[model samples]
Target: MKQSAYEAAVGLLSRRDHGEKELRSKLLSKGFAFEEVTDALTRCKEYGYLDDSRYCELMLRNGINKGWGPQRIQQSLKQKGIADSRIQEMFLDLDIDWFEQARVTAQRKFGSQVQRTKDRQVEMKEKAKRFRFLQYRGFDFEQSNYALEQLSL
Candidate 1:
């Protein structure tokens, strides 16, 4: 699987844009030597063919649509080798009201069920469960609780 630098770079671009680290990792996995991969990665960066920030922005939108919170999104970007500073800048730049979004999402998922509860305790528990679900969906505890409360009202 010896791919010429141009071939590998083009192959990568043909699929989707990749962050430098991700692109390099893929090239290495494809058996490109370290120096070659580095050169390819540098070339990609120089030509503006790859951008971690753009990747973060795209992933952020996707994560939000899928009902994820900032912490979860940040953690994921970090795992992809994105810098913390850039992650912060992008998160802030996106200017998302995460709580409101999560609240809306929770309401959509469980609003009808709230009306069917037979007891306050049971309802509270159910709401808590919904909160936990949002947490798993990448929301923080505070955001989850706030979302549940908003929907409960």
Candidate 2:
């Protein structure tokens, strides 16, 4: 027999936290009716089994552990269907220093050797490469430059 919407949602939550949109999509894909899905979601929220704020906090902590910057984390949260207002609120209260994160990420990746190059052109190229890498890692230019400076010192 097919599982009920509540059962399916509970089972999914047993494995890991899921955003409301993600859980709803999964339930719909499993052939649950729209009303049933909505009801299940509401019940879960009412019971404290589903919370976007908790999910956001977990994602933010995980991202920081993995050396991800705020930009990337925000983008990821948005993609996961988290509301912009919640995301902003979480960021506002977060104590993480993004520039320090950038520095640590750079140190972890390239070590303090970023300033060893003596040739001006080669140094420029190296700095450019580091900039691109940090940018790809979701750091802004100012943060990236600050990281490079820290490495030079």
Candidate 3:
């Protein structure tokens, strides 16, 4: 049985939400014509089944839950076809303190490593490793440093 583009789109959305651009790409890759994909997207929008703002909000919350920093979250949202202005607006409205988030993330990741060691060299190495992990998590130097400081306490 050949399913229509709208049917396929709804099926995909039933499993999870998707941004319009991602949905369109998936539909196109499934061999639907451009016009079919476009129509399906439009219909989905009309039904309020496809909302970029809702998708962005979900992604942002998911990123934070996963302990991802703003830089990484922004990049992920952009990849999902969210606008920079939208992302910035959401960020402004968010009450999260990124510095505190960084500190918490570091503590979760390296709590045991913060134990005092007789060897200053070992302590320095541990700090470096923690800093690198924070950086890889999209935290900037100041955020990472603040995290390291907090973890030391």
lDDT of 1 by residue, 1-153 (tens): 655875787688779877777777888888878998888777777887787878888878887887777778888888888888998889767877888988877877876335756688887777667877898878888888888777653
Worst lDDT window (10 residues) for model 2?
A: 112-121
lDDT of 1: 0.79
Candidate 3 segments whose C-alpha is farther than 4 A from its true place: none
Kindly give the number of clashing pairs for every candidate.
Answer: 0, 0, 0
For model 2 the TM-score comes to 0.94
TM-score of each: 0.88, 0.94, 0.94
Q: Each prediction's Cα lDDT score? A: 0.79, 0.91, 0.90
Q: How close to the true structure is residue 136 of candidate 3, measured as C-alpha lDDT?
A: 83
lDDT of 3 by residue, 1-153 (tens): 999999999999999999999999999999999999999999999999999989999999999988888888999999999888999999999999899989888888777346788999998987888888988887888999998887763
Clashing pairs in 2: none
